[model samples]
Target chain A: MLATVDQHDDTSPEIGGIAVDRLRSIIERVERLEEERKALSGDIKDIFAEAKSAGFDVRTIKQILKLRRLEPSAIEEQETLLDIYRRALGM
Target chain B: MLATVDQHDDTSPEIGGIAVDRLRSIIERVERLEEERKALSGDIKDIFAEAKSAGFDVRTIKQILKLRRLEPSAIEEQETLLDIYRRALGM
Candidate 1:
């Protein structure tokens, strides 16, 4: 009954007996976080650009960034699999 | 030369003539953003928990979240492929 609308309240909207306001609040929180994510992505890109300007290889630096996110053992295992795959493909 | 260390400075360390300080700065920036990303993920999970407590299906909500992150056409195409695969598998 917490988020249930008053039946007599004509201005209020309800879906499945739940108030529209509650649903909207839940959706709006996700929307706000999505905007923040976009901004953060742009900020990260700006840092990459700075690294490039400083004579760094942005592509390699990005790869390094991703590799650093993983455990060393995981990277080594992935490398082993990748090498096997390349060899299987006769590369 | 801005981030290049003085060759005469015994305290300075460099890799391929690039200062470790510069490399550390780049790594640290990514580390900071990763922390922020983890915090944001927790916030999103909290919202999902709120929705779940309010009688919403969190698994379906998570699917909706991922679907929202993609283009409508992409989703439709993926759904088509998924349906074909499922049918082929007699599911």
Candidate 2:
């Protein structure tokens, strides 16, 4: 019930000396980014639909995109680690 | 020299049944999203600066945000896994 804005009263609780305005601004900004992220994700899904129409494997394409983001050395290192872990687990 | 847009000539190579136009569109969209993500991250950093100015631990705040994103059960499982791994490594 403390939704009162622009008040200098003790009723307005500021936890740990955090300014309510600043906290609200940060939250609003993050929410805006989250909205944009959701839109971008939808766009990505649309692209996946297009790719599927062109006979592309969506899962493989996603994997390729993720792998392309990684450095070649990093990919190699990860593969080596996976091998080691599997060996250790007797898999 | 292979940036010849709008030509159906054999000089425009299509790799592995992938449409060059579609591929370019996908890459452009991903790049745009990447740029937006970078900008959003900078905005988040600005919020961290504001928080720090208000006597908050930026690192701890970052950790709290990350932990907040995870489901409670998932976090508990991750903590259990970490403990198990640490014990296995004798750390």
Residue-level lDDT for A6 in candidate 1: 78
What DockQ does every candidate get? 0.19, 0.09
Q: Which 10-residue window of candidate 2 chain B scores lowest in summed lDDT? A: B1-10
Please state the error at residue A46 of candidate 1 in Å: 1.1
Model 2, span B1-91: residue lDDT tens: 1223344656546765555766666656765776676676677677767766765566765576678689999999999999999999999
lDDT of 2 by residue, A29-86 (tens): 6656666766777777787777677666677667767788899999999999999999
User: Which residue pairs overlap in candidate 1's backbone?
Assistant: none
How well is each residue in B1-91 modelled by candidate 1, as lDDT tens digits?
2346678776658878776777779878977886787788789889988887887776766676788889999999999999999999999
Candidate 1, residue A6: how far the Cα is off, in Å: 7.0
Worst 10 residues of 1 chain A by lDDT: A1-10
Using DockQ as the measure, the top candidate is 1
On TM-score, the candidate that comes out on top is 1
